[model samples]
Target: MLDRIANIIVELKAVTKEAKSLARKEILYKDELKKIKLENVALRGQNATIIKERDQAIKERDQAFNNLPLKDNPDNRKVKELLFANKIVCQQRDQALQELSIKREELLKSLQEAKIAKKDRDISLSNLDEVISKLEAYQNICQEVKSKISQGKRVDADLLIEYAERLLFEEELGSTSERKLDYLENSYMFTDQASINRSLLDR
Candidate 1:
């Protein structure tokens, strides 16, 4: 019975160690998600600025075209140069808007992925809490068993030890599951961009 109790304590220690590791990973993933969210927000702001600038450029181009005096027979060369410059500016604005649109789409996709990762992290944390609760319950039972043993009671501490062992095993399983979920979620996020780019390149 003593040997069993010793093994149970060892197993509990291992489970707690794994739980701590999983908690650390959860924090890391949460930080990464925050970074991605910030990047997405910045990209959205940039896209909005690009759109506003494009609209302003279009308005300016229209105004310039309207202000030109066609009947003045002015130096057509100057008019032509102004028109050319306006066209170039308008084209540049259009290109910038187009690029901004593409970037916005990419950022939106990344933001969605980050949200999913955050959800996974939350779930992992919830599981960890449940495991912690179970560990506390098992610890209480072990204390009771130790008191009985001290009183010279022929208590079957084996039952308490076994229960603790089961609880510890469950905790380990939860930690493993959480780790796997985190890994899979992160892997999907990283690979999604690569997969899309590969398909585009192929096309």
Candidate 2:
């Protein structure tokens, strides 16, 4: 009977010890569960922050889409503006080239007209030279005639008739007026035509 009681007492002691160990394990498990709950709360806060940021981004994107035209883009508009400007530049350049061509044509025409005018001037100068030559020859013959008359040589009948005819012609021309005297005084100098400008010098 004592041996049976001893075995019963041993078994009861083992059961009590096992109960205490199980109690300690239960406490540890509860602590671990509390930590997990705290971690879950932190994760929930992070998730909320991420969701808030995503919502704000979506709102801004929707606002931008509603404000802008469907087909409008900044880069596309800039390229079109550049193309328009380039077309304007091309037009201006072409207009300038056309104006330059017209100016060149006008310049060429002016050059041709100037060449023609130069030719006319050269012809006029040549005619004036021939007239000067004839006047010089006439002056030399008159000088010879005057010198012979000064030496008391009588002029021929033909010469006398010519002189008479010239005097009669001068009377008909009205140069016998006082204006002839003024003309002789002002223009009978050596600068008249040739070196023998002595016709009106003896006024």
| Model 2: lDDT to the true structure | 0.50
TM-scores of all models? 0.47, 0.39
Model 1 lDDT, residue 122, Cα: 69
Which regions of candidate 2 fall more than 4 Å away from where they truly are? 1-79, 156-203
- Worst 10 contiguous positions by lDDT, candidate 1: 182-191
* Model 1 C-alpha lDDT per residue in residues 19-125, reported as the tens digit of each score: 56866876786677678667767866876787677668767866766687877545677668667876877687677667767766776776677577667756765
Query: Which pairs clash in the backbone of model 1?
Result: none
Model 2 — which ten-residue stretch has the worst lDDT? 188-197
lDDT of 2 by residue, 1-203 (tens): 23443454455455556555655665675566556556555655665565566556556654664577756745576556655655665565556556555655655565566556556655655554444433333344445456655866543433333443454343343444364334333432333343323533443
lDDT, candidate 1, at 112: 74
Off by over 4 Å in 1: 1-83, 165-203
Give candidate 2's error at residue 47 in angstroms.
68
